[model samples]
Target: MSAFPIDYAAVFQALPGGVLLLTPQLVIADANEALLWRAGRERHELIGRPLFDVFPDNPDDPDASGMRNLRASLERVVATGVRDSMALQRYDVEAPGRPGTFEERYWSPVNTPVLDADGRVRLIVHRVEEVTEIVRAGAGDHPVDRVRMEAELYTRAQDLQEVNERLRLAQVREREVVLALQEAMLPAPVPVGHHRAAVRYRPAVGALNVCGDWYDLADLPGDRMAVAVGDVVGHGLAAACVMGQLRSALSAAARVADGPARALEVLGIYARSVDGAESTTAVQAVIDWSTHTLSYSSAGHPPPALLHPDGTVELLDGATDPPLGARPEHVDRPEAQVAFADDAVLVLYTDGLIERRLEDIDVGLARLAEALTRHRGADAETLADALLADLLPPGGATDDAALVIIRL
Candidate 1:
């Protein structure tokens, strides 16, 4: 009715916690979605009603303090024009479909005064946090004995603290083991011929243990060499063990298989036979230095990016089959080939490098291409460092990422 329009319903409902608006006389004016759900009442039933009339204390119960405490807090907020917080109070709500009955509820409520331009109290914002679960969960065997309830809560808190400490120590030990496994497995001084090779690997931050990201380099019978980057399903000792097994199996298959495609096919078969290597994605490639040819195969993995000598970027994203161990039948690992000019860099990476929660993979892929174009003409190590810096600055990755760059 006033000249000023207040369309604050949408804004208040957008808040994460429960919010209620009360008039200067302590009458219910509006309530947000959170508070409506928490109170289990309709907007028509609460709005334009006096607060005490809607939620009066039980007359038969001598221990009813909800009305008294809430009234005292709201009075103080109105008098001093300051915020006041009430201790946890058991406020009962009218039972659904029942006329004059109530259900017990506990809430931690805070009352804040909203002042008008003239420094007069316009409205009161009542925010509540339900603490019934915490109270009921810690209730002791003797419900009437306050001393027993407090003692039980103290004992439970000590037990929880001890359990947390043990879990923390176990996580530390698992991380050390995963790190040692990675250090022992990942190739160092990567095997290279006429072209240069540089590798970078970063484990996910705040990981309880380790992840299943790995990279390997192996020499073939011809002047070509095999390189691979892969990720298993999960983290910790189980995934780390599976990664080691798959790496060894892929390396062995590369020696006997005809090309990169065949090598991945063989590796897929081996992974299916393993206990934990199922549902893994990998990119395997054989680069021939003499012919300057690259033959690569993918198994449900992100496509590789090729940075030409002239800074033109290409994504070798061809049709791919499902990940290993997806089906009993052998999935075809499709291979793609491209000839590279001198100083060309080909990067094979895991999804962690280019995937983020709630974002399209195309966005990340474009960023990767841009980074490659910007860092043209740099050597393998420099290019890799630059790409990692651009894509994953500090504390960026939520999953493990590995990169293998081959410069011809």
Candidate 2:
């Protein structure tokens, strides 16, 4: 056999993988240019340095499990001795200004003999393949797979954003529509030169945008002021249309309403032909403010609650009948009342104002009264807001609410 001499450095440099040969005491015995470049260190700084101290064994990456993980990987490699692939296994290598970035590196003790012409393991060879990109789903060219996956992800994100934008736009439009219709139903607060007043209406949680909740205020001749609130039975465009008709008819009825009962009879008869049970309930009052008396009527409506100056409240119960939509014969006329106080508050509202499935109507009414009691110090607007907050049940409501607070 012919004897052969070799150049160890040239041989190692010729290899493709990043290679590092470490001495027993942890000094970098030798390292290929590829290893030095990947480690981002100069050749002069590479050798004569401890593996942990020189390489930095990236311990900052939690997935790499830190230094404990780095040491564990070394332990397995030393125990096994045989080189193994790290395609599945993960570890970390130090990076400048970073604790450690993850990577997959293989370790194998070099087969070169320590004793001359004798077979003995002397140096440990570390082969590192940066598997960070692979673990992060950025590894390998994977042209067809990666390109298609990236395109799909981008498309999905765009679609979700577009859908969310559309949803937001639709909500805004819905609110605008509700506000518009509500405005149309209410008469500009007719400034009763001699009377001070306030009105408020709020929609329920599940109530469709713009349903039939309505209110009206008018200064009729004969020193009488007519006020009314009613709910139609439906929602959306149809409900709005019918509500407009009801509001017109109610306003006209107030002209000759005389008393709460007669005007309601006019309404009941009109309702039978227009929208019997299909319509909703309401309470109307014609106030002869000068006399300090109110002529009010109820049609399947909760009675009006009176809040006194002393913070006490009372409800007016009088001739009442089923909602107009039920049947012409089932309707009742309005009632005249002299029971109202000289310096008191009167509140009228739709069913949505105090109706909740979580509590009975009486409880809701009691809550309303309690709310009124708490608002003794509040002006009309503040009192109205407090009433809404207090009367609205836990969770939410499913209908529209309207309120008119009149202080006499």
Candidate 3:
């Protein structure tokens, strides 16, 4: 399987128009030749540069509307993902020759957004056509004519802003519908044979859109209970629908397969057959109290934390395969076993529980182990609540968080 789901860099270069790829933070990650031609610079000079740093407003001029207008237009494009066309921009750039000098330039620029699989902006496509001649032509017009032109431009900008607001409001409503559908499909807390299990799910902050995080508990034959947690890549309605299908398939496979390992293998097959679940990460476990054994398998997922009765914490990092749909060949889903004693707790969770921006995943895992160790004696529900309250940010989480605890 390819390392990157999409080769956006290649796509950007192939396009005929000038293009710039920006990170979510608005830093330039790449630039195409058509864009470089306008700047009179090579790829290395501008590839990793910030947009404003590369072309700041000419400081010598008192009316440097370049920076002000450009910034406002780009902000609108990023926020709304709507294509924006400016009437005429007088943004100026540094002159190639004299040091500490500025050059005046006129341009008609258009900005558009490039979205990733999750419906989030991954890049911004900025295209410009030099309109210096056309703009200069208007210089001979009467003063009153110029004022009328300026008023028309202002009216058009207002119309675009109104349309953009409507688009954002509609998107919010659609997200709510998807969230309701996902919530309705989730199973309630239930008993699995002799074991009792509970799950907690929280949607990510901002619009409460549906995501692909899900957890399930199944009662298997002969005193066996199965638990699984998974996260699908991306968000919105398509991801939620794929998550629902995978959850049902995994539950059915757990009941028929010989063990957790075989069940994961079967699930991989089903995941590939489905249209949207190939990039999912998951962990599945079958706990048999009668045998006092816990068998589990991981598919490119964070290992489960096991809290022993004697205050020992163990992260079950066993032989694991790549995410479900990444491999086409037969995958060997090995099941690792550990002794399950009465009153011991096993915590299964999605990556959101331990993943944070700017923090290493190992650090997050260590924090979880510490939290579980501190609350080793509490009931499953109390422990879950404490973990969330302590770990999640006060402002709110940026991704969906789901965790399941099976107390034996």
Give the clash count for each candidate.
Answer: 0, 9, 0
Clashing residue pairs in candidate 2 are 58-93, 58-94, 58-100, 260-334, 261-333, 261-334, 276-325, 277-325, 277-326
lDDT, each prediction: 0.80, 0.65, 0.79
What is the Å distance of residue 102 in model 3 from its true position? 23
Give candidate 3 misplaced runs (Cα > 4 Å). 1-140, 208-210
RMSD of 2: 24.6
Worst 10 residues of 1 by lDDT: 152-161
Candidate 2 — what's its lDDT?
A: 0.65
How far residue 79's Cα lies from its native spot in candidate 1, in Å, is 42
Of models 1 and 2, which has the larger lDDT? 1
lDDT of 1 by residue, 156-223 (tens): 54454456457557777888889888879887954565445899888875435258998888877668
Mind sharing the TM-score for model 3? Answer: 0.69
Cα-based lDDT at residue 353, candidate 1? 81
- Model 3: residue 279 alpha-carbon error in angstroms: 1.9
Q: Write the per-residue lDDT of candidate 3 for residues 1-408, one digit (tens) a residue.
A: 678798867776766666676665667788877777776667877777788888888777775666667676778666555567765666777766555677666777887877542335667777777765675567547888766755555466556656756866777887887788778877888776666786899877555345799998888888888999999888888888899998998989989998878888888988888888987998999888889989999888899989998878889887476889888688678789988788889999987778876677998899899898888889988998998887776656667889998777
Q: Which pairs of residues clash in candidate 1, taking residues 3 or more apart in a chain or in different chains?
A: none
